[model samples]
Target chain A: MIASTSIHIERTTTPKAKPPQDKLGFGIYFTDHMFIMNYTADEGWHQSRIVPYQPITLDPAAKVFHYGQTVFEGLKAYKTADGRVQVFRPDANMRRMNLSNDRMSMPEIPTDLVLDAIKGLTHIDQDWIPDGEGNSLYIRPFIIATEALLGVQPSQAYTFMIIMSPVGAYYPEGINPVKIFVESHYVRAMIGGVGEAKTAGNYAAGLKAQDAAKEQGYTQVLWLDGAEHKYIEEVGSMNVFFKIDGTVYTPSLNGSILDGITRNSVIQLLRHWQVPVVERQLSIEEIYEAGKNGKLEEAFGTGTAAVISPVGELNWLGVKLVINGGATGGLSEKLYNNLTGIQYGKLEDEFNWMVEVK
Target chain B: MIASTSIHIERTTTPKAKPPQDKLGFGIYFTDHMFIMNYTADEGWHQSRIVPYQPITLDPAAKVFHYGQTVFEGLKAYKTADGRVQVFRPDANMRRMNLSNDRMSMPEIPTDLVLDAIKGLTHIDQDWIPDGEGNSLYIRPFIIATEALLGVQPSQAYTFMIIMSPVGAYYPEGINPVKIFVESHYVRAMIGGVGEAKTAGNYAAGLKAQDAAKEQGYTQVLWLDGAEHKYIEEVGSMNVFFKIDGTVYTPSLNGSILDGITRNSVIQLLRHWQVPVVERQLSIEEIYEAGKNGKLEEAFGTGTAAVISPVGELNWLGVKLVINGGATGGLSEKLYNNLTGIQYGKLEDEFNWMVEVK
Candidate 1:
C-alpha cells in the first residue's frame, strides 16, 4: 500500500543519445526510461523499477486481450524557462485515473504511488522534456489488467506503467480553428456507462464515428448523449467549452463525459479572473440557435494534449456553421496563455498547479 | 487484396511436450503456433505467418492501447471420432467477424485470408485439440489496430491474429442450470453504438456490471437495452433465449445485440426441427410475468465459447424465481445434445456446416 518503502532506479544506457526536443513526434518516440510496478493478488503492487524503454512481454491470454479491462490518463511534463521540469496538476489526473479504475473494477492506485511513478520515470527521462513554446514530454500513465485467466471477474493481477512520448504542438500550425462533426448516430458513453472515466473503451467506441467524420472532412467527432442523443456530451479526446455573451459555459460532469482536468482548470481560471462561468447541460439546438442569434461567440475543446483547439465550424445534421467570433477568441487565448504561463513558469503561480521535479 | 499467396510459417521450437486434457481451463492453455498477418494502408493484409506462440511487442502508443480499436470472434475446432479435425461453420464466423469489423471502422479481413489463417494455425496445432465429448480447440480470431498513433481514427496499420486455446467444457458439472443477475444499472451497448460488433470496448464496458453480478453470486449479467434498460439484450457473453409456452423467442438483432454464430445456429436448428421461434424485443417484465404465468418455460444463452447455458433463475428487481418446469428443460437438452452431436460427428452433417481442414 505504501510505495515509499521501495524504489529502485535503473538508468537508461542509450539515454536517447540525442535529446527528444530535436525529434518530437506525437507518440512515435519515447523517453529513455519508464516507471514499472506489478500488482498480484498475493503481494499487491511491488518492486517499483525505472526500467529502460523496451517492449513488454505479455501472455496471449492476458485478461486485457479478451476483455479490455484497462484505464489510462494523459498529462505532460513542461520544461520551464528556468530549466526546471514540472508536471501540471498530476494529482488531479491520478484522482481521475483511480475513479476510472473504480468504474472498471480495477485495483485502486494510491495517489502517492501514482505520483511516485510519475516522478520516477519523468526524472530519469527528464531530458526528453522539450523546451521552447508548445513543446513538452507527453506522459501517458495507464493501468491494465495483466492477469492470465479466462473467468471474467476483476483481474487479480494488474500492471501500471508510465510511458512518455516527446510531443510538439498539438496544433503545430498555430491555434488554427478546426471543424467538428456532430455525430448524431453514435454515442460515446451512456448514463450508467463508463464515459466519465478515461478508460480505453470510451475512446474505442468513438473510432468509427471519428473515421466517418474524417471522411466528411472534419477534425473530430462531437459525441452526443446516448439516452436522448439531443444533448452534447464531448468531442473526440477533449471536453468542450462554449462562450455566450461575455460568459463562459461548459458541460458539467453528467456521468457520460470525461471529467477533464484541463476543462476544470479553465473553469477555475475563468472564475479566478472574474469571468462568468457555467456548468450545465448544453444542447445542440441551443448552440445552433446561439450561433444564429449572434450569442455564441466561440467554441473550443480542452485536454492535456491540446490545451485549447478553437472550433472554426461545427457540422451537425447536414448543417454547417461558421462559428462566430473567429476560430481563436480573445478569452480563449487569454485563458490558454495564463494556463501555459503557470505551466512554463512564465507567470506567477497563483493556483500552484505545477509540481516541480528535482 | 488477394491472399492466394501462401504465408511463411515459423514453426514453434517449444511445442507442448504433452497437451493437457480432461480439465483444460478455458483460454488458459494455448497451442504451439498462432496465425498472424500484418496490414498497412499500402499493402493491405500481407506477410501472413504461422508463428511460434509468443508475446507480441506493441508500442505503448499503439492505437489499440489508447483507443480500443479492436474486434474479435470465437469459434472452435472439433476432433471427430474419425480423428479428422474440422471447424464448426467458420464461414458464418467470418461473416460476423467482418460485420463486427465494419461496425468498429476497421477494414474487413478478406474471406480468403480469414479462411487461410484459421486453417494455417489450426492445422499446425492440430495435436493440441482435446479428445472425447465436449472438448475442442477454442479458436479466437482477433483484429487490433496496431498503428502507433494517438489520434482517434481507424488505424492506418493493423495486425490480425488467430490464437487457439484448448478448452474442455464451460461448466465441468454436466451443464447444470445457472442463475443470472438481471443487470439494471450497467448497459452493454446502444442501438447506434458498437454493441453489435464483437469489439473490445463493448466487453470492457460490461466488466464492471459483470464484477458486481459475480459479487452478488450470479453466473453472468443479463444486460438490458440502453434506451429504457427494460429489454433483455444478451447475457454476459452470449445471446439469450426464452421459451414462452410452446413458442421459442429471443431478442431480435435490432442493431445492438450481437448476431452470434451459435445463436443463428440454434434458430436454424429449432426451425429445422419444426419448433416455432421468433426474434423480437423480449422485455424483462414480459418474460417475468410469463414465467409467473407458466408461459415462459425455458431460458438459455448461446455463443461460440459456451454452446448453450441454461438460465436456472433470474434475479430481477428482488424477484428471484426458478425457471419454469425444472433445472433443465427438454428442448434445451435436445438442442444442446443435437448441436454437440453434430460437432463431434455423432449426428449426420446434413447442413454442410463443418469445414474439414486440408
Candidate 2:
C-alpha cells in the first residue's frame, strides 16, 4: 500500500466557483479535484494521484462496459459548526467495499490506502462541503474494470476513483413520509447472487421495477426475496424496518440483504434506548395483517443518503396499506433527528462513530 | 426510423494492417472503422455516423461506470466463397437487444436503424473479415447510459456503438468435447431478474463461479435453477441441450435462461431433420441417471461464440458422469457441421437466416 505522504497532487488551474447552495441538487455538480489509482496484474495498485476532475477515456471494449464488473460506495463529508469537517463511519464503507470486490472477483483494496485517499481528497476539497442544514459533500468512490478485453472473465486492469459532489437534503420538503410500492414482480436478487454487495449489476437490474413504481406515483419499490417472493428483502436500495406493537423488526442478514451501515447504527441506537428490536424474517403478508388489525405502527428505510425515510403507505398488488395514517411516526422522527444531529456535530456522539477531518 | 441512406461515413486516414488469420483470437483485434449514434431525451437518437474505431470519452460520473446501465449484443459477419459478406440472423440480435433495452430502462434502437448500422459498418471494413476455416468477424453492438450523473436512476443520454473484431474458432483444438462443473453454489440469475436479457450484470455475477470451476480443472460451469437448484438453466454463457434415447432435450425458457439465437436455430434444424426435440425442465439427477444407464447419447451448449460445444463429462458434486466416453458424439458432430456449413455458405441455406451486406 502506498503511504499517504506519497500521494501526488496536481491542482487544477481553472477552478470555478461553487454552485449555489440552494440549487445544489444531488450529484449534478462535482468538485474541482478527484482522486484516482490504477491497478494491473504486472504492477498492483500504483500511481495514486489527485488531478482535475475531467472526462475519462477508455477503449470501448473495456470489461466494465460489457460485463458490468464494477462496484461503488457513497458517504458524505459534513461541515460542522466552527469550521470543522467530519466523515461518519468511513471504515464501515471501506470494509464493505472490499466485500464487494471479493464478490465481483476483483482484487482487495487495502483499507488504509482507501482511508488515506478519502482523507486526502476530502481535505483538498474541504471548501466544497456545504454548511447549510441537511447539506453535505457527497463522496462517491467507485472501481471499474479497465481491461480492454471482451470475455467473461475477471479483468486484469482496474481503476479506483473518488469524486465529490455538494448536495442538499434528501427530503427538500423536510423529513416527510414516502409512499412505497410493494413489488410482487421483478426480483432484485436471489441467494448466491451479488445482491449483498454494492455492485453495479444489482442496481441495474432494479431500474425497470423502480421506474414502474415511479410511474405509479410511488417513491420507491419495496423489494421481495427472489427465491420465495414472500419475504421482504429491502426498500429500494435501503434496508427496511417495521415498528409494530412497540417492537422493531428488520430483516436479518440472509445472504441476500446488504449489510447497511446506517441500519447497524439504528439498531445500536435503538438498543441503547431500550427499545425492543429484533432481526428476523418479516414477510409482507405479516405486515399487511398487522396493518389490517391496527397493530402496525411505523415503517422506515435506513441508508446513508436518507438516514431514515418513513414509509407512509404501501401499495401491494393494488391494496394500499396505510401506516401511521400516512404520517411520519414518532420513533422515526426521533431517530432521524438524533442521527442527523450526531452527523452534523450538534449532538454528543456517544458511539464514537464520527471521524473529523484535519 | 431513418433510412440506411442517411448514415454518413468518415474513413480513417491511417488504416491498421490486418492481423494474421491464425493469430486472431476472440475479441482481441478490431477493424479500422466503427458505427456510433447518440440519444437524448429531447432529440432521441441522432447523429448516426461511421467513424474510426477509437476510445470513447465519458464523464467520470457516467451512469454506466457506477450503476452498470448498459446492454450489448453479439453477432458475426462471415466471408463466403463467392466473395460476399453476410451476417447470420442480424434481425434476431436486434430484437433481443431491444428486449435488453426494455429490461434495463434504456431507449430502444429501431430495428431498421440497427440493421443499417451493421450493414454500413460491415461494408466499410469488409477486409477485416478473416478467411481461415471457422474464422469470422465478430460484431458487438452495445448501448451505455452516458449522462454524467451519480444517482441510481436511468440516464437521459445514451451512446450506441458497434465494433468489429476478427476471431478464430472458439476451440483452437477443433470442435472437441469439454468437461463442465455443475454449479450449485453461485447463481447466475433468478426468476423475474435480468437473466433473460443480455445485460452485463448477469455475466459479471457468473465470473466467481466460473473462475472457481476453472481452478478445479473444468472448462465451464453448468448453472442450475436459482430457487430449488434442481433444474438446469444454462452452461456457462450458452444455452444447454441434452440427447437421450434419440430425443434432444433443452431447458425451457423459464424466465431465467437466455433466449439464445443459436439455440433457436439448432432447434429448428433438429425439427427439420425429423429429430424429436423437447423443451422441458431437465433435472441434474435425471441426466446422471441417463448417463449411468448408457442412455445419454450427447450433450452440447449453443451460443454465438461457440456454435456447438459438446459436453463430454459433467462433474456434479464430485460424481463424474461421462457421456460417450469423453469423445464427441455423432449427433453433436452433425449439428455442428450443419450449423457451420450454413453460416459459412458451404451448405444450402434452407432456412434463409443469412442477410447479405450490400
In TM-score terms, which candidate is top?
A: 2
| DockQ, candidate 1, vs. native dimer | 0.64
Residues A1-358 of candidate 2 have per-residue lDDT tens digits of 3223357999999986999989998899999999998988877888888999999999999999899999899998898887888899999999999999999998888778788888889999998998788999999999999998897889999999999999988888899999999998899998888899899889989999999999999999999998888999999999999999999999999888999999999999999999999999989999999999999999999999989999999999999999999999999999999999999999999999898889
True contacts kept of each: 0.61, 0.85
Docking class of 2: high
For model 1, residues A1-358, the per-residue Cα lDDT tens digits are: 4333466788767666644454565777877887878888777788777788777767666777667888998899999887999999999999898899888888888788678879777887887787767998888988777776666567888888888988887756667788999999888888888888787777777877887888889989888888888888888889999898888888889888889899999998889989999999999889999889988898989988888888889988999888864568888788788888888889988888999888
Predicted candidate 2 versus true structure: per-residue lDDT over B1-358, tens digit per residue: 3223367899999999999878998898889998999888887888889999999999999999888889999999999998889999999999999998989999988789789899999999999999978999999999999999877899999999999999998877789999999998899998899999999989889999999999999999999998988899999999999999999999999888999999999999999999999999899999999988889999999999999999999999999998898999999999999998998999999999999998
lDDT of 1 by residue, B146-220 (tens): 887776667888888888888988767677788899998888888888888888777778888887888899988
lDDT: which candidate is best? 2
Worst lDDT window (10 residues) for model 1 chain A? A16-25
TM-score of each: 0.96, 0.98
Off by over 4 Å in 1: A1-5, A17-23, B1-4
